[model samples]
Target: MEITMYDKLLQLPLFQGLCQEDFTSILEKVRFEFNKYPAGSCIAQQGKACKQLIFILQGTVYAKSIDNEHGYVLYETFDSPQVIEPYSLFGMFPQYTASYHAQTDISTVSFNKSYVLSELNKYEIFQLNYLNVISNRAQNVYRKLWDTHIGNTAEKITNFLQLRCTKPAGEKTLQIKMEDLATLIDDTRINVSKVLNKFQEEGLIQLKRKEIHIPALEKLIEQYT
Candidate 1:
């Protein structure tokens, strides 16, 4: 691997805190596959078995999750240097929760589950990094359960998005009827529309027929919360 690429890989959460020697040792022992995807190409599908650990090395990836029971689809875009659901590699359901597609021409580095257990897991730093990532995710979700109450309509809507999204900073799209969204947030349709229109006017979001497009979720959250 090129020194530049190695440096980029070191920035990833799973590889952080590792010395150059350990990093090089793991690389020499494990076979890491590098792949490129064009824009609009499907990287992974929801419910597919996650047999490998895929780390986005370049470009952007869009993730979409459909809640058939809830009658909505959530879309989120992730930039490079992000892992695609590392926790999904283990557990009873070992499957991706959302479908992912390349938003732009992208490159990725991946290794199978067998390599993860037999090679990566043997490193103490790797184990600690992996554990911290999973633990932090769990704690964030748990904390959201207690943060359900928001008096302001905008804050409530922002909270709803933050709770559903896997990452707080990203481009997000919520495909649902205004009425359905209002119902979910326990607000009147008129009131929800009013606040959304205000948001659109302030350049926070774009309101379309049955869709709400947030250019930047972090900015939206900051504005409202």
Candidate 2:
């Protein structure tokens, strides 16, 4: 394996604390499947079984969750050195909640469930790191439940984005109609537009047709949260 590939693997949450020797040993035992994807390619489909742990080594991918009943599609961007739904690999559903598409030409490395259980789980650091990742996700979702009541249109809009986002900080693009967003936040279209316009003016976001581009999602969260 290339040194750069090892470096990227080390950056992942599950492999964070492994020593060079330990990491090398594990790698030797497992056959990691490396793959490349072109921009606009569908990497994974929603509702498909998540049989492997896929780590994005390079470039960007967007996850789209469709709500057929509610008639809305939520899109969240995940950049390099991020894992795709690690918690979903062995859960009750064991399926992807969102469809993932390559936003740029991307490279990914993946290991099947069998290797994860037989090899990765044996390492104490890997086990702890995996638990931490899952625990943090659970805690985040739990905390959001208590943050249900938000003040003002601006805060509501920010809260909505924060809840749906995969990460707290990133360049985010929300693909939803103005009226639909207003409905979701329980605010009037005029009020939502006013707040969004203010955000755009402040350079916090760029409002395009049926889209709101957040240059840095953390800044919006800080301003509103």
Q: Which candidate leads the pack in TM-score?
A: 1
RMSD of every candidate to native, in Å, equals 1.4, 1.7
Alpha-carbon error at 128 in model 1, in Å? 1.0
TM-score of each model, paired residue for residue: 0.95, 0.92
lDDT of 1: 0.90
- Evaluated at residue 85, the lDDT of candidate 2 is 93
Per-residue lDDT tens digits for candidate 1, residues 1-225, read 568668878889999888888888988999989999999999889999999999999999999998888799999999888899998999899999999999999999899999988989999989999999889888988877566556688888888888889998878999999988888888899999999999999999999999999999999988787
Off by over 4 Å in 2: none
What lDDT score goes with residue 99 in model 2?
A: 91
- Candidate 1 stretches greater than 4 Å from native: none
TM-score of decoy 1 = 0.95
Clash statistics: count for each candidate: 0, 0
Model 1 residue pairs with clashes: none
lDDT of each: 0.90, 0.88
Compared with the true structure, the alpha-carbon lDDT of candidate 2 equals 0.88
lDDT of 2 at 167: 81
